[model samples]
Target: MMATADEGVILVVEDDGAVRNLVATALDVHGYRHREAASATAALLDLTSSTDINLVILDLGLPDRDGVEVIEALRGWSRMPVIVLSARQEDADKVAALDAGADDYLTKPFSVEELLARVRVALRRLAYDSPATPTEAAIYRNGELLIDFGAGVATRGGEELHLTPIEYKLLALLARNTGKVLTHNYILKEVWGEAVASDLPSLRVFMATLRKKIEPDPANPRYLQTHVGIGYRMLRVEEAARL
Candidate 1:
């Protein structure tokens, strides 16, 4: 949110050889060059000392410290995006990872296709951070939904809508890029971290809840609009904003 992609590096720190190779290979296939670390300490050292780590793919089950600990430490000095890669099978772990500072997560035994897609989303979240404000990541608005990129906050008709952590994130990802069609996998990877991808029905339930909070007409949502087979889009706030 603070800086764009051209501003630095994309760091990947994982301990599992299979996962490391798979992830690293996936990134390579996608033509993404990155830095990798086998432990949290090395990652922290790299993160602090280097000025180029634009994003991070971290593992919670580290040899030295908790994977979440690295994220907390890095967050102390920077807001670089952190995506967790772990085999931890608990919803609490996913929540803690996200609460700790991770922007996304992926469980073990994930497909290269899914991994690649997540990489795209995490990197896309940094779209505003590019060298230029490319049109794809251009400032978006609809009705009363006000997105102040500089503030990382949203408002409706001069009134702020208090959002839970997940709701706020869902809005930012969907609303900030209005017309774009994001998929469930994309949203799940971004918001729930990678461990919960199989929970699509749960994703739907959250979407419904999220819509009720932000939509003026939850039954006929005007802003948090669904795209049927696709994900969702925030109908231009101007369409519903009380000008």
Candidate 2:
């Protein structure tokens, strides 16, 4: 049975008519309501006209204007999730889109399963971040670092640690998903967005900065362990404290 779901409305912004149709058809079959726009201008107009849009699947190669600008403009007023669907596979391009505020990025020739998985992850995050979602952890302890998600504070050895917004988000995401290996793409989507998922250098740079603050020795991270070509892992209590 095709399970009926009120997953929420989505806006598809793509210049390719066939691609747009494909995406719309998939969303429809999955029981999601969607609208389509052929250009950045149309996308902006649709966003302004409609207030119920829960997510946006945007293509970076639009005819009217750069999709990065659209992402920035939308970030100025909205927290709606954006998944960038573009053919540009270059790392720089991906970084630009992600840094612009895209929640997820998908290269062209992507599989339907991958696209749908990204959509589900993006929407799941949207719900978790929503105020309607109740949360319980006031303090998260991973070795010496203490993250107070409720109070928006993090401390090390009893002193509050100053962390950038991105740094904090990274830490919180890892802490919540403790003992799990988060792929680079997953981290980017959850932390920065999909557009920046392919920007491994940027992720490494931020991770380095974050380690300096929390790790007793950034050279030898006790809490944040790199998974070599795969991603990163936050070890469980017993595994992480082996300093």
Task: Point to the candidate with the largest TM-score.
Answer: 2
The per-model lDDT (C-alpha) reads 0.70, 0.78
User: TM per model?
Assistant: 0.62, 0.68
Error of 1 at 28 (Å): 2.1
Candidate 2 has which clashing residue pairs, if any? 98-195, 98-196, 103-193, 103-194, 104-194, 105-194
lDDT of 1 by residue, 36-104 (tens): 899988988888888766778888999999999997887787766777778885767876776666666
**Per-residue accuracy of model 2 over 1-243 as CA lDDT, tens digit each:** 132355667899999999999999998887778899999999999998887788899999999999999999998888788888999987778767766666666788877766776677667666565443246546788767788776667998899976545566788888888889999889987765554466576577667667778887778778898999988887765686664
Residue 77 local lDDT, model 1? 71
Best by lDDT: 2
